[model samples]
Target: MGTPEVSRSPTKSPLTVSTSLTETVDGFHEFKIRSYSLTKGLGVGKFVASETFNVGDYTWAIYFYPDGKSPEDNSSYVSLFIALASEGADVRALFELTLVDQSGNGKHKVHSHFGRALESGPYTLKYRGSMW
Candidate 1:
């Protein structure tokens, strides 16, 4: 008989965060973001980013907070979402988020499956202009 195939998942993955500044309609700044995941054995893993973001010129950065959850008895996953605002604006931006592991490289990408946020809350914002 053929050997049974076994499957495994990533135990820990390296995450990279990237950001860009662009011009948007209504005199707002459009921030383009791209996040990368690097893996040793599987090579370059995954990348996630927003399609387009709208913010005020005074806005300094974007923040992403990840929450941990256990859906099954022992299976656990990480949930994530975004919060955005300017230094002076009293209002902030919040949205539902989801991630998926399409390539199965033990890395997760923002997609239809994987993890999601159940609610929203105030989050501290951090900004990085260049990639290292």
Candidate 2:
């Protein structure tokens, strides 16, 4: 294989002490949906909204669909998304979603947007962005 090439960009140089910002979250909220299985009957591309919960200064909800969110998937996979309920633009945040296993074991499926190289730092949500 040929040697890999690395690109040096202006905006994305490297993280340094002076250009870093730290945020500490005291705690988090766990909103469990008991009847998650019942959503399977929902039509394709359909989703059910969870009760609104407060986190930090904004209200948020979890949108879950037993079928896939897009038509191309043909309902093979479940689609999940977090949406902003409150206002204010350019919201920067970190989030993690886990699917717990029911086999009486500790293993669980995890998906997250954190721990990745954020070119301009954490993602900036547009004013009331949907399907985040």
Candidate 3:
């Protein structure tokens, strides 16, 4: 036997393709909250929510759940998220969160959308109540 016969599915349709674009900003909002540890006493259930801030053209707030966001975690880990606090839907943007080290080492850890290539434009908020 030299070569094997290849079978193809004729019923399979061509895949549809979609693409999106994200706008980049020259500067960041740089909202810093000091004494973050003090907020831990607030306890779960919206432990601490940042004041409404604007990023791009939409308003947003940072929510920190020191005791985990869902009940499944049982407060083992801290959960941080960004919430859309403005009107409109399908809003898209890039974001980054940084946790500063109190040691003054200047080696803060950062997580951001720019770490990976965006295949679907900016992050879509979907609705006014979306979170990321």
Candidate 4:
């Protein structure tokens, strides 16, 4: 009969780890809607999208729902959204939507992540995600 021998190795004092860095790359695109009256007839839940633009290596677009995105609204109000138009997952981004003033009064209405007083991390948009 024969017996087997066993050996053990000592643990290393320092463990090695690796990490990656990402510097934010910024880009912008502006879309304007002309003939607002013509869009209202497009119907509820229907939207017109802007041309795709690239930022941080991803494609994005703006969607305008002239008759509101929800069918339940009965076309009471208009809606707008920013969407990730390309194939991607867990994409992080910030968004700004503004309604420009046609009049000379300079009273444009703005909805923006940039205007917030508190510091915030970018939003995580999953594959084919849209933000209102």
Candidate 5:
């Protein structure tokens, strides 16, 4: 008689995603938009300041939406509030609003700042937004 074969189960590993900045609008000054894995440090934590700008002119706004359907679908959205940095070395925290779906396959919008500054140098800013 033949011996019975043994069975084994496959192991699972952690998921790591790589995100990039899709767009940066250069209006009054320069604003940058960046995306990264929520598990990674890029999504949250202290923001390393780069340059200083006129506080009066330092105003920013962001708009976000899910990938599929519109408001009728009861998707998710986010809004960001930005301000000028008091110092070049100032560090800030970027907020990440959670969307209904864990997957970021939905469409989102970010309207604020400009691409000029982002294009000029390497810097990070504070971001505050929401999702539903």
Candidate 6:
């Protein structure tokens, strides 16, 4: 009778990562464009920023691109963006950008990351990290 030899390989257990998220509506800011006409003529890719506001201990601003960011579009549409305007690292939050109707009909256009299911998660913004 003969005995068989077996070999063993060195291996480590798989590492697991866990993250818990606490969601809160930390802050809100309302911006108004008094004269929308004067905002034009800034040329493509240029933007006017709203006064800095605070949200979650971070400064924020709304950027209005009157002529849109795309030069080829030729002002076909206006672009608006929310930006993290202060010093921070990997700051995360949910946001809602809304265009309120002043006509008093109560209809509004809104782009939001609230009261809905997110495929990934909330957004993260670093210091001055924005397309605008």
Candidate 4 per-residue lDDT over residues 1-132, each given as its tens digit: 779777879878898899999778778788888887899879999998899988887888888998999988789878878888778556877677887766659887777753652257677788875564
Top-TM-score candidate index: 4
TM-score of each: 0.27, 0.68, 0.66, 0.73, 0.21, 0.68
Q: Per-residue CA lDDT of candidate 2, range 1-132, in tens? A: 999999967787587665667664533556565677787768778987778887777777888777888888688888777777778745676677666765559887766752454343555566674555
Task: Tell me which of candidates 2 and 3 scores higher on TM-score.
Answer: 2
By lDDT, the best candidate is 4
TM-score, candidate 4, is: 0.73
Model 6 C-alpha lDDT versus the unseen true structure: 0.75
Pull out the clashing pairs in model 5. 25-114, 25-115, 26-114, 26-115, 30-114, 31-114, 63-109, 66-107, 67-106, 67-107
lDDT of 3 at 32: 63
Each prediction's Cα lDDT score?
0.35, 0.69, 0.71, 0.79, 0.35, 0.75
How many residue pairs clash in each candidate at the backbone level? 1, 0, 0, 0, 10, 0
Residue-level lDDT of model 5, residues 1-132, one tens digit each, is: 899998979978989999897443334433333442332232222232223434333433323222222444332322333443333333232323222332556754433232233234533553322111
Model 2 spans with C-alpha error above 4 angstroms: 1-27, 114-121
Q: Per-residue CA lDDT of candidate 1, range 1-132, in tens?
A: 999998988688679899998443233333333332332122122223334355444333322222222234122333333434333344432332334454557774542112324254323344333111
Tens digits of per-residue lDDT for model 6, 1-132: 789878878888999999998756568788887777787887889888789988766778898788887898598777778888786556777777787766779998876753444555678776674532
Give the root-mean-square deviation of each candidate in angstroms. 27.2, 15.3, 11.8, 6.1, 21.9, 7.2
Compared with the true structure, model 3 gives a TM-score of 0.66
In angstroms, how far off is 36's CA in candidate 4?
1.3
Model 5 TM-score?
A: 0.21
Off by over 4 Å in 5: 1-27, 32-40, 55-81, 84-108, 111-132
Local error of candidate 5 at 79, Å?
Answer: 8.5
Q: Can you tell me which runs of candidate 6 are displaced by over 4 Å?
A: 1-25, 103-107, 113-119
